[model samples]
Target: MENRQENNLVIKVHESDNVAIVIQAGGLPAGSQLGEGTTLAVPIPQGHKVALTAIAEGEPIVRYGEVIGTALAGIARGDHVNETNVRLPEAPALENMPLATRPAPSAEPLDGYTFEGFRNSDGSVGTKNVLGITTSVQCVAGTTDYVVRRIKNELLPNYPNVDDVVALNHTYGCGVAINAPAAIVPIRTLQNIALNPNFGGEVMVIGLGCEKLQPSTLVSDQPVKIYENSQAADPDANILSLQDESFMGFEEMVDGIMAMAKGHLEKLDRRRRETCPASELIVGMQCGGSDAFSGVTANPAVGFATDLIVRAGGSVMFSEVTEVRDAVHLLTPRAADEQVGQALLQQMQWYDRYLEQGQADRSANPSPGNKRGGLSNVVEKALGSIIKSGNSPIADVIGPGERIRKRGLTFAATPASDFICGTLQLAAGMNLQVFTTGRGTPYGLSMVPVIKVSTNTALSQRWHDIIDLDAGRIATGDASIADVGWELFHMILDIASGRKQAAADRLGLHNDLVLFNPAPVT
Candidate 1:
């Protein structure tokens, strides 16, 4: 890389912007000049925005050429733009918004992309082959987790083709409003996770026998209890009842579990990766620990790569309802048709009501970490967040945990919380993930490959062991969004083909599954 020390130091996200983010690592100090005469009134931290010119109180602070927030006090040229100076704005009403407002996605379709993936019997392809053991109730989690560890030590070594053994555990079942109208949500989430393509459709359930979420209903979508393991010998064998009388002690319990797990490992060991088209890839896109450069660099590069995947007939999901809520108008118009537009609005409305029911608003978001990183409010974060969808037409919109039947860019409705969002995306059948972080996180999931992209080179350099791509190069003029995007796009194919391991994968860093349970807890 060239000596970019003298490179353009401030990033003005849009030409109409009244503020720009300082890109220098230590930030430009007071008296330092940007361009010719914009002198800093105060030092601005890296990723923090600087006022472009004098602006009156109550005026909109623009970023990405959109109304991200309003200035709470008069801001002068070279002043730092912080959340205290930027007031949060109200969310848009769902009624009568424009529908199908944009023409078909304008990015030319990409072609000839292929990857080596695990093609399943159901026509879906996965990037990894793993044995997943799902717990029907939180009560059995301890026992099941023990079984998973035992399998890893004693059985996994013999199954070279299987990537891992993930215990799909969560805090639902037995307690709380199981029969409530919204209870179906968490149930559906756990059920689908068991069916995630990466698991090779090998559904193994550990039930307490008395939990409301019985294996019968949890695995209702699949052939029930058809696992080759015997129910008579280790009657505690499968359909599950950790309390089954057949289990005399901990040893008997362990034996039953090992019997079931061994069967899964043996079958999974026969699976192999084969060359597959990029269309078979189901990718979930997300961002965490974000900063201003996210919209300008990493996410945009992700957006470009998103377009590449969509054009190749692959499914890409950009989720986090709160993150995209404010910028949704930009999305509805890009919907494939009026139905998609309506569906998009409906989900937004649902989330709006969901928030109101809790007596909260979108303003409650854009966490303290977000504020420190220069996101003035949720609106600005949203504007930057939505760009990950690129300009691709949203072919469909699905509720959390619902599998996407259509390819192209699909919006999966989920809370902005990283763990829950990733879990929902996994249930939606994503075999791969692209996560952009400006502030940075070590977040990863065991079920799929999560490729991390840094918004700035500084973060990439610092966390090179964790971040897979340095999108910050775009901020320093070292690379164009297209340059990094093409690099990332090819990287996705390689990663999807299992030819490369993401930093998280290499370090074995992963987060636990967190189901989206809106029903009342008992």
Candidate 2:
């Protein structure tokens, strides 16, 4: 079990793994000599692999203590373990197992867990205090944007605590049937935006007079002010004036909202390190721009972290139900109840029907980039993707834009589109998101802080600004998955308390919204 360093190359992560990862590059030949007792099994590159022992075909290749795939050919000691000689085993169908048979995790509370959030009038907490400028349709998007642009450049400069002035503009809202199913979709989407935890104080809705959607119809008694385009000679000026008055009069009316925000930041400055119970945390597991290493490195590490969070009584949610495809059996036995399992099955069937009607299969996922990254099949991609959910009981299933009510582990129904799913997840009330990627993406929601994790060291270093954590070390054998998972957990808390800004936030990449278009009915 002794690892000796040679020629600037070192093996750091020594799990009970049959392989060791090369951590640095050196001009070592295939038969290069190492320490007195060691020799090169193969020429290894930094962030690649080396064999610890001879592997036979069909033998399981273990990394991060999970069976990633099996060896395809006989491999000698110190040989590089990669795709040429490795292939994933066919996953077995899920059995009908009872939830009670699964191991029960101990009840533990997250220690000293608290976020400096705005406590809303209705008791919900908000991470950001936004003053939203909303419009009902694309026709009014220009007006809405004009109002927000004026506020951002002119008014918000005075209000230092207001995070940003945002406009909820969309392409849809007109040209679609305004009947039961059609209208309900956008209506619910708008309502979710209005009630999102990001907005604390107030919102101003501006609607074009003749649009299918109306501002008056959407406005409720929820601390919102409305102004129709028909009401003013200059709507932008009126809105600006209203904003000025609102910020001015809020000192007396809102009483302590600003002061509370300021005090919360001060208290948040004290960062005493403490191990909180895992159950107090809720993790949103997600992947985007995935590659082969995704399942092996980042996604599995995220899964291990998900397990830690779940075992500690915290919850985790992973979606993209359509991508589950043939892997539904893997999750069914873990369902909290028969109803939950049935609900998942029903959703899968519905998605299949929808896809078939379009003469397409949802399995036509894994974009061109994914294919180039060494993933060949949707099942292979999904088998790896599901690792992010960790090993937990599937306590519940949630529909699109639905609030996460049940506590334990749940599966949310979100499409494979990252922006749409991410936005919907945020709207579903996830306080934060843990997004893993290999190719990299700059996407974030308005309120929820997305922590971007890289699956490989090269991407992590190349996109350092965007990637918050690097599980690539797992691939290079520099760190264990569990250790990386621990690091990720703390990073979550750091972002939650405003100590860090995910790359998406720093880039101001928050143009995400729920898409509500449906297939046209005959």
Candidate 3:
């Protein structure tokens, strides 16, 4: 397990699968033997699949026990199977899928799992003690950043109890069809993001007075209400409009923002970390830069850890609509009830229509990097991606930016793009996040602590300083899935308790929030 010289070999995901990914570094040369009778007929790149048996053209190239694609050409024994040899397949039909067909999973309460976290005025708990400066529109982003930096330099030391101050800047909030039917997604996303549990329920808004998304209308509350006239009724919501006559100069605007941020920081400074039950953790699971090993190594390990959180009465969220679209049949039956199953379908249908309007389909997924990493198409990617939820019964289907009120595994509808997905999950109240990558990425969210898990040892060693955990040991037989899962479980508690900072947080590597505005930009 220490080195691949003794263990480099092909990895077959399932017994019935005909294609296996090459695990040997730099790939194996032509005529190399991979088990008996499976001789390489051509070069196979690391993490790319090779044909385990001869197959006729148009035959199914199976991986993960499901059809990834059909062989576009006759693939001989040990031939490297890639996009050139495999043709994408149509997605699984969505209608009439089975509902609640599986038995309910055990609802046993796990013991002794707790973390030191900030207790908020609301019932919610926070993993960080930071003042969040949210914007109603993007116009005030520059002013907001100046204010946030100043607060961090001159003001943050005075309020040592507060972690840091951040400007929640984004590309939306103006010059869009805000009245369109599809506009609700981005609007609610902005609203709910301000309400993220990490913010300690301290809502602040900076806006340009003439923006389409009015400051008064962006208040986020529970029960999923949409303002009919885009107006807010919460008088207590803090809003600093830069264009207000109260600010006649640039200095005044910065002063006004700094003044408001200080108030929030003072309140945040008083908050202290206390022992809280693990149930307070609302965790979001996602993947990017995926290679074939993603499903085999990292995702399955995350899945095992997901169940652990659920047993501890914590909530785990798995999203990315297109990534899960092809696996609805496998997932629908695991729903907690018929309604949950229906909710899954409704979200799927909405995405289908959304993509159709653009004349593209799920096939648009599995980007160039994915194919290079041996994912032939979306179907193959879906099979690997869906394993992140483990076997926990889905307790709820959260719409974009909606709040979660229950504890268990939940599905939050979002596109598969890494940044957009993270934004939507943050809006859904994810105080912590676990991200698995195979080809490797430095993706992280600004508002949450993201734990990066690598699928293979190569990536873990290469990006040693950045990746937080390595599930790659399972692939090399150095550790079992359950072993790595428990390791990650404990790591989550450490991160949540502020005993450690994830690499993303340490490097300040964060992407600006990208709202999923399906509405047309006017």
Candidate 4:
């Protein structure tokens, strides 16, 4: 619930929540009277929390009806509740938690929605028709990039049906323990990204002849879960080796790549958009630069949209393992079954071990930008971040860099870094993504269309050119989550259908693909 007293708007998420966030831009002054006989004990920044009731030291500081932290000292009513005065709380125990105990979702099925998309021979749908050139080793990224630019400027004009040419460049495939057990993560990531639906199944690979990770291994029939009928065969035909004996110079290498790309472009240019059901859409949900309003507005609105997409029989993925670690207890019961529930726990436990191995913990998250935006710690941030998942049953779970197989909601485990999370989602077959931010970011992906949703109207209006939607209306009481959600859902279809372009795409913004290489350097 929310209240406006003396022109001061305060948002309290739950009745049991003893704190409420100040909503006024630039914040309110000390002595300002808030509702419920509460007066500002001190000035509070916008999106920062204010204690609604006085509590003794060592008491739990609650938000979203969960303990986010413990007060380090006695806190007075209307005082600020922030990291300085709050100590981090222990994470929830993973043992003996409820599993698949929530009742099945009963929302009426959303029907009659369709979008124009490119249908691949593999029976997968593509939101964009692009020729993707994959590089097996980082040694070939420069040459591949040069070829991509040449193809885009020289050959792309003739292929009017093709959308864009992307160089799948990353810093992997060399100087690493290629045979390490964890090496499969980056290797398969490179492979599955080649099979992304938007590439139109015209897979192309470029590599240096003597690199540790061979180009053939990328397209080989391994366990990367290649889409059915995908073009993952005849590696010699698909790969262009820059260091081959026939390539005498850099120019020849460039020409060789462009020649291969032109062939893929010709096939991609022959593809046309056809009507596909909403179920064909695979959307990845992520958040960055989050403030308290991330949960109050943007994420919840995205969550509502997530539920809508699930109802329409489409697939949705919510990732960022550390961001979800502290809130895993809230999700276990929502799993589709005991097996799915256990999968969720396994991913959480795996991430926990991964963090421990690095001598890090969940405290490493809720970055400085996040802290400045009023996220006290990872615990508070986790509660807010999970709101992007909505209330859908956990249909399946996949580890880092694995492809999503089932429809509906799936938790794709990934680190909290914005670039890494986005890259893995691409490998997992996401054709479109919706990212929420509050402190603001210019983050975009070259492989997919990313819809940026701002958690506050200030950010939306400030970064008007880049932000696709304003979920801030929910915080200001100008709209409901359902209203913004429906708008977002419609926008997703429009962008997926190529009927409308996201602001990021229109502005030609893109981030480099950063692979998650957990293996050791050899």
User: TM-scores for all candidates?
Assistant: 0.96, 0.73, 0.95, 0.96
Model 2 residue 126 distance off true place after TM-score fit, in angstroms = 2.0
Candidate 1 residue lDDT tens string, 67-169 = 8888899998888888888888888878888888788846666678899988888899989999988888999889888988899999899889999998888
Of the two candidates 1 and 3, the one with more favorable lDDT, higher being better, is 1
Cα error of candidate 1 at position 483, Å: 1.2
| Candidate 1: clashing pairs of residues | 101-333, 176-522, 234-237, 456-472, 457-472
Give candidate 4 regions above 4 Å deviation.
1-8, 221-236
The segments of candidate 1 whose C-alpha lies over 4 angstroms from its true place after superposition are: 1-7, 226-238
Q: lDDT by residue for model 3 over 1-522, one digit each (tens)?
A: 011222358778777788888876677889887664688888888888888889899999888777888999898887889888889887778887999999977657788899999888788988987778888888889988888888889889998887777888988888999999889988888888888878887657888889989876766453322111112223233677777774568887776666666666767778899999998889999999998889888999999999999999899999999999998889999999999999999999999998999998887888999988878888888999999999999999988878776899999999999999999999999899999999899898778899999998898999999999998887778888889889999999999999999999999998788889899999
For TM-score, candidate 1 versus 2, the one ahead is 1
Choose the strongest candidate by lDDT: 4
| lDDT, residue 141, candidate 3 | 91
Clashing pairs in 4: none
lDDT of 4 at 390: 95
Global Cα lDDT for candidate 2? 0.63
**Which tens-of-lDDT digit does each residue in 1-522 have in candidate 4?**
232322437888877788888888788889988868888899999899999999789998888888899999999999999989999999899999899999987899989999999998889999999888888888888887888888889999999999899888999988899999999999888888988999988878887888998887877852332211123322225677776776667876676666667667878888999999999999999999999889989999999999999999999999999999899999999999999999999989988888899999989888998988889999999999999999999999998899999999999988999999999999999989999999999999877899999999999999999999999898888888889999999999999999999888899899999999888988
Score residue 159 of candidate 1 by CA lDDT: 87
What TM-score number comes out for model 1?
0.96
Better of 3 and 4 by lDDT: 4
